[model samples]
Target: MIVKCIDNNNCSTLTLDKEYPVIAEAPEYYVIFDDKNQETTCKKTRFTIIEDDYFTQKAKATITELNYQLENEFKDIKQFTIRKNSKGEIKEISVKFKYY
Candidate 1:
């Protein structure tokens, strides 16, 4: 199977017997299949995984909600971090506040 990292424009060809890392910084990508021997006349097909869409949308919503809550309830916040799991799922959010 061949996987293309849509955001980074990177491609990797993998065998069926080995494990691969599907999660990445930019989770958007397409899986492509192409025959190398018939380069001139071969047909290629690509597939998009919807998990990228779901995770991105969920992360955006979580970020927006956190920002709003922090702005209103924690005015001293100086920085924040959005944590994600191995599957690229949002796990936890941490914030640092300034003390005066």
Candidate 2:
């Protein structure tokens, strides 16, 4: 999993790459920065599993975390072949802003 900060107009993006089947989760406040650290204001952020493509011999479990977890029960790498994992696979989950 890789984390990044997007400094364009108060927005940031995070990217995660897993070799095995895993649940990708992000915290409600995924992108956080203290006002004291910087002169800019921080806004509320949200994350979601916009896309899911996990196939195994058994049923999968629900992902309910602010972080990513890998499931190696099947150990089969062929299932993910159709879906290529690369820099291009990154997806934007959400955008944040202040109410006022």
Candidate 3:
């Protein structure tokens, strides 16, 4: 899952308006990789989910983790295809982004 920081909660680990990946979430908080790529627990109120997909291919991870050099290349994504299993677990995610 991807999330954008909304409040930052006066913490240094997060920056408002920046997108971060939610490695996991609990009832009241989310586990996110901080700016240093360290796992940090943050309150749910600090961020809002941007996208959540249940596909095994890890497309969400791919897109968010792609090298910065390619970030521009994948900007302006045109479409996405997500496949889910019977239990609603993601099986695959295929994204089509515009190429400059």
Candidate 4:
């Protein structure tokens, strides 16, 4: 998710009004990549969400999610491949379930 800094809270690494990319998040804090590309945690009140990114929206991308789905939801013979580019970006996701 993208977030714009509204309050630095006296953090020297933060610049007021600067936008940052939140690489990870939970309920109360955002793990944002700072201006220097350093991973840092900031309170949720420190910024306002600008937009949700791929990670936040990719509901079934994580291994845990895939395991749950493949086990409980798709309990059939299957094959899958998650294609990625050289840059490690997901290009395609292929799943083949049992013909039954």
Candidate 5:
């Protein structure tokens, strides 16, 4: 099963063999099983099942669009940097242009 972390600082998707029990829950964080089925703690607001085909489709579309933009819009970009959060979710992108 695929799950998404709802935490803003760690908004990333994870694949798991099966669902696990919540070891603990708090106002800011919680604990659950990670992809390896190991007990892992995360933000309380994090971790949700990725249900339905709509989300998957949208994710693919978004990736395609991002690739297109990188190839076209950023063709002239001299340098760029991608910033991701703790969960490996992209947080910010910075681009630099060549000056001639």
Candidate 6:
């Protein structure tokens, strides 16, 4: 089995061999933090990722903990907020989805 993974600092993805399934809510933009400062960016819908979080060694443990927390904290979260750029593109939006 092969698993694919991709990361963009503020966002990270993990895909298992095309068998095991994982689901998540989509966000328009993602917020990131760096030594310089915090920033936001656009994200395309094609992979599994978590905004404001990374799948890294230093963060692996934290991410795992968050996964469990989100599942329960957002049990009834049918809506969230996502920020967008002036260009009308999803950029630097919050990890939270924006519900109508």
lDDT for each of the candidates?
0.47, 0.29, 0.82, 0.83, 0.62, 0.40
In candidate 6, which residue pairs clash?
40-92, 41-92, 80-97, 80-98, 81-96, 81-97, 81-98, 83-93
Cα shift from native, residue 31, model 1 (Å): 11
Candidate 5 structure quality by residue, lDDT tens digits, 1-100 = 3446544344233443334456666677656666566777675445665553468789799677668767897665688899999999999977676677
Candidate 2 lDDT over 1-100, as tens digits, reads 2223333343332222211112233343333232223322322232233234443212243232112223543332223223334766744333222233
Model 1 ranges off by over 4 Å: 1-51, 74-91, 94-100
Per-residue error (Å), model 1, residue 61: 0.1
Q: How do all models score by TM-score?
A: 0.30, 0.15, 0.52, 0.51, 0.30, 0.20
| Candidate 6: RMSD to truth | 18.1
Better of 5 and 6 by TM-score: 5
The candidate maximizing lDDT is 4
Per-residue lDDT, model 6, residue 53, is: 29
- Candidate 5 colliding pairs: 29-44
What is the model-wide C-alpha lDDT for candidate 4?
A: 0.83
Tens-place lDDT digits, model 3, residues 6-34? 99767987888999988998999999999
Residue pairs of candidate 3 with colliding backbone atoms:
54-90, 55-90, 55-91, 56-90, 56-91
Q: Is candidate 1 or candidate 5 better by lDDT?
A: 5
Clashing pairs for predicted structure model 2, backbone only: none
Candidate 1 lDDT by residue in tens digits, 1-100: 2233223123234323222223332334422332332212111222323345467789899789778866898676789799999999999878776779
Better of 2 and 5 by lDDT: 5
Clash counts per candidate, in order, are 0, 0, 5, 0, 1, 8
